[model samples]
Target: MPYSSLPPSAFWKLCRNDRDFLLSDIYQPKFSLTPGMRIATAGSCFAQNIGRYVRASELELVDTEPAPALMPAETAQRFGYGLFSARYGNIYTARQLRQLLEDAVGDRLHDCTLWQRDGRFYDGLRPNTEPEGLGSEDELRAHRLDHLRRVRAIFDTADVFVFTLGLTETWTDTDTGVVFPTAPGVIAGQFDPDRHAFLNLGMGETLEDLSAAITLIRELAPEIRILLTVSPVPLTATASGHHVLRATTYSKSVLRAVAEEVAALDPGIDYFPSYEIITGTPFGARNYKDNLRNVTTEGVQRVMSVFFGAHDGLAPVDRPDTGLARPSSDPDEEDAVVCEEAMLEALAPK
Candidate 1:
């Protein structure tokens, strides 16, 4: 029988001896990151790993919502930044993120009203926590206006926006078209048909929205480059009708495709194939960590290998002209140990 007409089993058997068939394409590259580069990270929990690994290397990692006095974990929980930074608040889908940027840029502005009080602005949705009961409508509006201004400031200052595309499905306000961080029921809210709707973006729609976001970011800060990745961590749950396992596959496939599409369309935008590096068979059957859901150090190393290799042979980025000498090697090691201890302490039950 001709190869083209052979059944699937026969085809597999014939190619069984091709040792280089799958392995040939799995190359890991080296990445050279400069010190003092201001990079902001957002997306799912897996994306947070980049911040941890980068900061651990003693490079300058930017956190827009830096906590004042709280320890690492407390700062993360209170201000919603770090390790699991929710800087923009649960941007699980590209549509939600795009909508956020659009709103920030004064395009596709939602009807949501904002007001100011006591020198602070608040969105109508986010309430003020004080000894008194819920704040008056005027007070809530003020807080929201202030929040919007702060969010804009973040966009203005960031040099690199490292966005990890997570999911393709989202729940949005039907009338206002405002995308919610979570589904209506999961959070303290109801989704009336007249006011809410669900969106499951296809590959094209995802790319379109992401492209718009990139354009908007450049308008705000033209120097800002975008590094896009697909989160490898599987979904905890899916609103899709399929079983959780199948939904994970569906969601990841869609998001990965979108990342590639957008990267191809723009030069400043780069796609780091972190998803393939971690989940691909080359890593073998072992889970990266004790928490199998999270990618392990070995997995991360593999991703970085490609990152470095891709920029191979280029001169190392020069240290910023600031007269600060590199921190001493021995002291740096000790600081890492201390930081790790502090991380653990911060995470202790409070």
Candidate 2:
């Protein structure tokens, strides 16, 4: 009798029978995201997709490290500009996100975060930003210092902050516990098992790190609203001894639970089900590409449709004329996500 009073959304059979599961009724925005709001996005590669939709819509997506006016769009993307609000490439872990905010405010100064390869230097924190590396350690540090200033500035001006949780497994310096975006050697530095350690964060640690990152975000931007989502893209490779499939599940589980817990604790924070839209069993994985790892354009469109529908009151399904732009036919113009984590695929022995 008590269960009969619940809405259709509360019953699995009712939701399963709906024509489109991603209906606007599924998500009611806690607060509307108007065109006037300044939004900043960061996190794993999937977050790049979120930034793209935000830009396509009337919403203002902040960009602090913009490429030069003359730079070609493709070239700018290759050099890690215009991917997100800042050039902080692929922040793949909650710990890394928290560390970045701390570094922005000079609370934590990490030494030995520089990598050298082929006679050029790279900032280990964001090795992929400069694919060829900088001329010297000084040049790299100067760029990184400037980036920190911009990162701090983004938070100061942002009205809404969107972060996508990507992975629980991260690599950290054994001595300082400072996290690197990628395994050192995979991008630039030489890997030393003794100096570097692989950490698989549990639910407790993931929750703590994300909570702290949110706390820092609010401290810097007192009125900022935080939106959290888990990256639905499967891990490219797993350093853990367990099979990759198992590892991916474990990583996502921890990240998803942390997002839910954090969102529940604060009215300023909200969780978007982008993860479910792409990976949920109900969809039968229709959103993934042939590789079954990369999300298809249609999948991304659906996610954005739901997002815009909730935030901007657009139609959630079959949105032919929504404010969001359609994906370009040319793959080059559409632009593939620049994922440093995918670099690990090179290490696999043929």
Candidate 3:
């Protein structure tokens, strides 16, 4: 009886058998977006794609810390200048995001360790952002201070905050419990079993970190709306000791569930199903490119099309021609998803 009263979308076959597969009915946005809204984006590597597409649309993607006028676009990107609202590179875990917010507001919850390689020192929290590492610890600290100031400005100005949940697995400093974006030794730091530890966050821990982060965000900007997404990209490698396939499935399942639970609890927060659009059976994994990891241009376009279409008066966002040069056909060169997790693959026994 209940089934009969529900809409056609409630039935799998009704939507699945349709010619276009009818994605329009899937996401009814909790709130409408206007072109004038200043949106701030931060999260994993996949979040970069969302930010790019948003910049292409009529909506404004807030860039608090932009590249210098003289720096080339490619060079700016390499030094982590133009990615994700601020240059906070690849925040791959909810805990890392929470710590960044705390540091920004002067909570000083965790004193980030400085990772060193050769004579250079890297910010343990964002090692990939400075590929060559800074010349000294003092210089790295100065850069971090300026970075946090810009991050605070974003919180003060943004209308909507978009975060993509990337992974449940993280590496943390044993002494301070500060989470790092990448595992130690993956990018710059030497792995020390006694000091650095791997953590796979459970459902409760993930929920708590995000909820706390939201509380801090609302404190800073009382009216800011939040949009959450789970990245469709699979894990590049797993330290969990399970087969990578099982590890990927587990990580994604936990993250997707966490996003759903968190979004349901708050009227101001919304979850977008970009993860389902790419990974669901309807696409049959065709959304992934030849390597079966990186999402293709067509895949990202489809996800963004549905997102912009959900807003009542706005036309679907067309993927803009950024005119950036494409890399060679090597699977590695396909897209500029600056994923530090991908570096783990190299450590696998050759």
lDDT of candidate 2 over 147-259, digit per residue (tens): 98899999878999999999999999999999999988887898889899999999999888988898888889999999998999998899899999999999999999999
Q: Tell me the spans in candidate 1 whose CA falls farther than 4 Å from its real position.
A: 1-32, 83-86, 107-143, 288-292, 297-350
Error of 2 at 14 (Å): 1.6
Q: Sorted by lDDT, highest first, which candidate order results?
A: 3, 2, 1
lDDT of 2 at 40: 98
Which candidate should be chosen as best, given TM-score against the real structure?
Answer: 3
Q: What TM-score does candidate 1 reach?
A: 0.68
Between prediction 1 and prediction 3, which has the larger lDDT? 3
- Kindly list the per-residue Cα lDDT of model 1 for residues 1-350, writing each as its tens digit: 36788543344344345542232233322223455566677665566566665555434566555545645553343334454222444456787677767766663334442323455443323211121222565554444444455556766666667888887776677667677655553323344667667677777888788888788788888977788899886665556777767877888998998888777777777788778777865455343544445455556555654554454442222212211233333321212111211122223346
Worst 10 residues of 1 by lDDT: 334-343
Candidate 3, superposed: residue stretches over 4 Å from native: 107-112
**In terms of lDDT, which candidate is stronger, 1 or 2?**
2
Higher-ranked by TM-score: 1 or 2: 2
lDDT of 3 by residue, 1-350 (tens): 66989877777899888764678777999988987788999999889888888788778898998989988767777778767899998988888888899999993423446777899988878888899999988888888888888898998889999999999999988888888988888888888899889999988999999999999999999999999999998888898989888988988898899899999999999999999989988779789998788898899888888899899766677776543566768765657667787787788797
